[model samples]
Target: MIRAELPPYEGDTAHLRKMFSYFPSGVVALLANVGGTPKGMVASSFTVGVSMEPPLVSCAIRRQSSTWPELKGAHRIGISVFGEDQGEMARQISSKSIASRFEKIPLRHADSSALFIAQAPVWFECSFADELPAGDHTIALLEVHRGGADPELPPLVFYGSTFRQLQVSSADG
Candidate 1:
């Protein structure tokens, strides 16, 4: 059996991204209504069910993010699970210029002021719970206020440095 030689790892940013790319995660849209303008960004680091008793979820944000400050002021934030067909929308929201993130996208908003993509398979309405710095990022913990899902719309998966679609095997059914 031939074993591949490993590169000398420095445990730097480059290596970290390369190694973590092997683990696929769901793509999510973090949205909020800041004042009268819609603000949002795409995150592959979103996680759910962090605390069952408190009903919490979390998303890791870069410490240098300029959007976090404005979003934190919102009364509530929306987390929309991207569908397999929304890869383009994800990139648009994550772009450098935040001015036009939702230019052509359809959106829905809850009474709590949490904005969401109308077609997302699932979405959560949450309020700021807590956050703590972790290395170069801050984990934003949120307490779920309300959420819903549509099983018919399958979620988008971010893996191997690209957006991929998911397929459920018949055996699982």
Candidate 2:
């Protein structure tokens, strides 16, 4: 087999985004009820179980995200890991028009006032842990106070710039 030489590196964000999309990542909806109003955003960069003792999870958001400000100030935030079947819902929530984010989705508000999407497989009740500057984005670290998952639901995966469901088979083949 022969290998071709690659182009020289250029600091282009579009190029970076395209390269990053090659890897599959889980998607999550970050939510909160501010003064009885449901607010949320879909994030594909979410990561879980950062620390066992402190119980930390994290997600990265653009520096200019308008939703991040409202979420960080809330007493508690809800993180709903999208189920494999919730790709369309994730896209709907991620839209720029916040007005229609939860237009037809069922919701759940925790006792702590954290809002979550009802059909998601996993949900986390978290408090803001910290935020660090990371290039053009801010990395948000959250401390998980409580969480739950539905064992039957598989996670939604973002791969090659599209939503996909993970499918694994037994070793019998």
Residue pairs in clash, model 2: none
Which prediction has the highest lDDT against the true structure? 1
- TM-score of each model, in listed order: 0.93, 0.92
**Per-residue lDDT over 1-173 for candidate 2, one digit per residue giving the tens place of the 0 to 100 score:** 89999987688879878989998898999999887788888899988878888999999999999999999989999999999989889999999988988999888888996888887889999999999999889999999998899877888999999999988777633
**Predicted structure with the largest TM-score when compared to the true one:** 1
Model 2 worst lDDT window (10 residues): 164-173
Off by over 4 Å in 2: 1-8
Q: In candidate 1, which residue ranges exceed 4 Å CA deviation?
A: 1-9
**For candidate 2, what is the total of clashing residue pairs?**
0
Error of 2 at 137 (Å): 0.4
Q: Report residue 159 deviation for candidate 2 (angstroms).
A: 0.4
Global CA lDDT of candidate 2, please?
Answer: 0.90
